[model samples]
Target chain A: MEQWKKQWTPLLPERVAEILERLPDDAPLLEIRLRCDRPLELVFDGSDRIVYGNNKAPIVEENELKALLRRLTGYSAFAWENERKSGFITVGGCRVGLSGRMIRTEDGVLGFSTVSGVCIRIVREVKDCAKPLLPYLLCGGRFRSVLLVSPPGCGKTTLLRDMIRIASDGLYGAVPCRVGVADERFELSGDANGAIAFDLGTRTDVISGISKSDAAVRIVSTLSPGILAMDELNDANDAKAVSEARGKGVAVFATAHGADGKDLRLRPAIGALLDAHVFERIALLEGVGRLTSVTDGDGLRVDAVSQ
Target chain B: MKTIGIALLFALCCLAGVRLGAKKAAPLKMIRAMRAGLQSFSDRTASGATLADAAEPADDAFRERLSVYLESLSQGSAQADAAGRASAAFGASDAVRSGAELFFCGLSDAPRAELQRRIEAFGAVLARAEVDAENESKQARVLRSAGFLVGTGLAVLLL
Candidate 1:
């Protein structure tokens, strides 16, 4: 109840709050998605259930969606102008995706003019989720650069986040390092105050609200981090940044939306990096829990029982 | 001596009535000031200033009142919404109050195009308010002038 109260209560309106309060403390809620003037639903266990619509539930007005957006953004549309153009904003330590017409100038996207839909993704910190991956991620008393491979929604981001925390905190007799996390989307850290909104451990530096490749290069040059972590690398720019960091001898822990390590080898730029042996260990995330397999730099699976 | 004292008193009373008449005839001047404040706000906004900074009026008195309204917004109390805040800016008329509120709210976080539209709408409302005030002032002037003439006649008769 406290967990639910801490995460959601202050954000919901009175009517929505009342309805959510009626449910049990453990609701197994994944998301609360809304498209303007459309039905509101709760995403749990990969199913969409109506959030508020019964004889008891209060009917929502069209303006309610608009009101929610203002509240979530703290009524500062000016500050979030860039994020709106990108079609999302991270608020209340959760990710809120927006969709609408694009606003662009000669330079690039400015922001959204009108937001019509919102998708709220609820993120929770799972303690010790990376416990099993530690041995494969470390070798000969040194941290090995790891790349997590998984398709979308396979929970790769969550796993990488925990691993960063574990590395920063030096859990399970491992050495602690000055870890740098480039959370480009503000998704992994949910920070606005120049500090991480989540528990990234004492030695972790989380920088967000910037382009992915640029952030990576900036952290590598300026932060002097012992290790680097990033979420969801795509395209040649990201591959180049990863190679740059690896050249600087900063072990990189990152995630990519790929089903398997060999699968990623077909993509030209990424395949080039793989061929160059940039990654020492690869963990391919399965549906929701433990990784399906952890492969070494040679693209060979390692035995869990071995040293 | 007593006769002279009575005559002097009558003259003083007549002068007071004339002064009242002059005060009543003064036109509603605030309408122009309000329009000017909005113009300054727009200029500031265009220069890439935040709404709070842009809405900071050039007039010292208006700036003080706006600060109070801003403080209330930051505190996020139900007691003071945008409408309540704008009430302190213009006349007590609901039209003026609502228009001011709409203008202020637009300045808070609106896009540039939206802000421009609200500003224009507010300007129109302000113009109407100016006309209304002018009409009222004209009627007040007529009443005060009539009072002055009547007082003069009464004083003349007394003397």
Candidate 2:
């Protein structure tokens, strides 16, 4: 723990630490907003979602966020989770939601490229973020495959990262599962110096620098991990891999981008994944990192009791 | 001794006449030669001919005349070496001695009439050198006189 503390302390800038320190203790995650002349707005929901902003906001897109994560983490490949409407990185368990550009692909209409105004909602986990959602996630002493959905800048990834951490650390009532993270990008751990700067969990096996689809297949078959965490399941290959992982009884945690329930179905990739019935839960994150909606695998809305 | 004095006097007179003539003619002759040399070199270079191939019969005549003139100057004074005589006759100073030698050598096989004309021109220039030296001294005296006049006028005005 001391070694980890020493390792991570140098990796994080003083400004980032100051921002992290300003976060609310009760909040699952904290947001640090950057604006010109506008006071930094830090918003923390009781869940593992946080939103930081200023009044004069810069436009951020799903591709832009993916590019940022790629630059920040030096990940090789990036893709938009067209089916779930999210942005995926090849680094850590970091999934970011993107808001602009929907183009046509051979596999139908997936968010092809990002242009103009866009917002990237970066997902991460705080210790207390997954406390409420953990119980429902672990049913009959086993994990269920879940798909987190959110609009741009929502806390789907933050919630998912926390869920994975909690599950791996055995914070919830369930046993500590070997969480295999196909972090195509380094958003979750934001790893520097080959070590995870940010904590995912003790037992989580993070495989960075590979496609989510490929990592999913490898982890399910070879690693035989208890839970597979991947970000931004966009393409048909990604959907197929996730379905295959679920078929082998390996619980999968994934995120996607969308405005609402209706908009999610409009996405061709997400629509197909839904048809395939790969996920048991479709958790919808909304407004400033709030879990506004939660639905079961059948697309039926379920009430989430506020923490 | 009297014969030697008479010869010396005659030589001085001859030297003065040649020098006077050279003062007027040497510059023109040098200019003409330079122009001719440049034209010849250009013609040869353009025509893709070697120096030997480019040497016309008239050029050979000029070289023969220059050599005879140099030989005559060499006969007048043992004090003047072959090199000095060659320089005076052919306008081939130490810097261009090799070129002068090559020119004369080319003419060794040419006709005698053309060679005599070249010799006369060379002798005339060599004889004029003493007179040109004397004229130069006279010009320096004139310049000094002019400078002294100007200085005296300035001193008088200041007083």
Candidate 3:
């Protein structure tokens, strides 16, 4: 079976799974969206289609969605409580984003009261995706701090994962060094039952199922990594952690949600890192593993500079 | 030869009474084992283990009884199917069996607090059942003794 089918099919209704299994082997299936009383939607490469059952659109019930959530979490909501708070569950490197009623208190949001919709993002590893930009990222045989910025569904995580693998494995003439991965949601590590599904290279040390800041600190202090890699640098705390690690001479490899560097500067958290020149290079992705441009710390195009 | 035949008849009656007595007490033992196993399952799951990983029995007896269910769950069998298999493997009374069926069916369908509450509630039910079974077993013991005595009396009269 394909990776996506093996990882995701069991988490869906049987009817839906049947429909998904019928898809061609080469289908570029991207996302599977399930909404209560709505037709099942399959997002392919740059397109989407509503699936039907018995000649009519398959309407999912609220109970089915809940059951699916239960199955995805291996029937232990408590085990996945942290992921629930984040409104997503990471399974085998694929993220299942959830939409539901928020349970809030005077303190803050507690968790979901009910899940109404689910979106499973399909993630596939593309080896050597970062090979093109490795030259700019490495200078004088030392890895430079690079932050990948892209819009949602543009493959930032995929690219970041490959870069980590290559960096840790010493691929393409890059010297192999210790890389510590703070896989807060288990996305980078694909950890299931304490076993890692992804090949993050033998030299990589991944600390998962914990907060990024805590994991980063623990990884740095204990693992003594030469490169510290993390995903989704969204908040000030994350930026602070990355900055602190960089200050300690660990090269930071991270990804963030933004259209480009300009969009990134609008966010005060990441903007602070940019202003402090925390990252030596910023790669803006156009699409899946496709980099539109690479810029230096001062926002100058590295390709242009080389020319 | 007649005396030996009479002795064999009395022994058979005593064996029958003992077997009946054990049958009457089986449910209590089964329920006790289930309660202990469920408690372990609840604690392990609360500590972030998956259903299959946490489905450990408290002792050897329950472990042997739950082997089929555990194997099924670990192999990714549907929750309902696994629970069914467990229910079939348990040769307890109807009431105890039904209660266990409810627990296994709902195991994977609720939040932690809800699940914990349900387990406690089921445990209480089992506790009450154990008391009832003890009282029934006491009655069964008397009946079993009387049955043995009555059968011996009949054999002696026949001789």
- Top candidate (lDDT): 3
lDDT of 3 at A307: 9
**Candidate 1, residues A185-243: lDDT per residue as tens digits?**
87778664556777888888877878888888899999999889988878899899999
Tens digits of per-residue lDDT for model 3 on A7-56? Answer: 77776887788888999877988899999878899988778899765667
> What is the C-alpha DockQ of each candidate?
0.18, 0.01, 0.39
Q: Considering summed lDDT, which 10 consecutive residues are worst modelled in model 3 chain A? A: A298-307
For candidate 1, the chain B TM-score comes to 0.73
Residue ranges of candidate 2 with Cα displaced over 4 Å = A1-125, A303-307, B1-159
The local lDDT score (0 to 100) that residue A88 gets in candidate 2 is: 33
What is the DockQ ranking, best to worst?
3, 1, 2
Displacement of the residue A216 alpha carbon in candidate 1, Å: 1.5
Report the CAPRI category for model 2: incorrect
- Per-candidate Cα lDDT values, in order, are 0.72, 0.54, 0.81
For residues B102-157, could you state the per-residue lDDT of candidate 1 as single tens digits?
Answer: 76663445766776788789889878887887776777667666666766676677
Residue range A66-128, candidate 2, lDDT tens digits = 334333232111111322233332223333333346677697755435433222233444567
Candidate 1's fnat?
0.25
List model 3 lDDT by residue over B51-94, tens digit each: 65776536555555456655565566777787787767666566
Question: Considering TM-score, which of the candidate structures 2 and 3 is the better prediction for this target?
Answer: 3
